[model samples]
Target: MIDHVYISVTNIDKSLTFYSSALKPLGWKVFGNYDSASGPEGVPDLYGIGDDMYGNGKAVGSSVWLRQRKVGETGLYLGIVCDTNELVDAAYAAAIKAGGTDEGKPADRTYFAHGYYAANVADFDGNRIEFVHKAWNPKRHV
Candidate 1:
């Protein structure tokens, strides 16, 4: 399992506003923030956002951190899982309202398999964000 993930952004405040709005529909909220001086050795400062109810018994749940982008740094893509297709659509709209560029509108990606619904958007920093809902049945797959 992934513990956490971080992405570099050109502007922290702008990115925060973008993410807070874009991810709200998916049940994520801004939870924490850290400065470069307070970060662990060799780690950059970041703004943390994620689902509060996740990883209840563990040290931490899945989270995405937005850090200040360094010179010549490249961006990264992220995929967030949604519980339902409606959430995917909502997230996509929210992202666009938050100043994100639409990569692909919400639709079924049959190539991935049946019941695969997703939407793609590019954040202000041009990082790709995908909201996906996959109706997977473990018993059936097995």
Candidate 2:
């Protein structure tokens, strides 16, 4: 399993707001943040959130970190797992409400699998992300 993922963002504050609000339903929280001074020289400011332990006011590197991007830089695509179809819809609605563009509405993505329910959205800077719940044979939801 992946330990963490970091993505470039145009604005730290805006990205933090968007991510913290949008991913709340998935049990993610803003565990830590740091200005450039918190790192080695020339490091950009960062904001992090995820489903991991938060102690000593730092994220412990088990989260998604948003950092300042280079001029004219772009983004990353992430597909997150969900437990149910309703969560896919909730996350989509929350993302849209937080100013994310609708890449795709929540629905069964038969194009991928028999019961691949998912929703897609893009962050303010076009980082495409999807929340999915795949219902498989024997009705397993993962």
Per-model TM-score on C-alpha atoms: 0.47, 0.46
**Residue lDDT tens for model 2, 54-132:** 2322322236879888888677757676667997899899999999998889988664447768888889777878887
lDDT of 1 by residue, 6-53 (tens): 788999999999998998898889987866564326446778888654
lDDT of 2 at 22: 92
User: Candidate 1, residue 55: CA error in Å?
Assistant: 5.4
Can you give the lDDT of residue 128 in candidate 2? 78
lDDT of 2: 0.70
Q: How many backbone clashes does candidate 2 have?
A: 0
For all predictions, the C-alpha RMSD in Å is 12.3, 12.7
Best by TM-score: 1
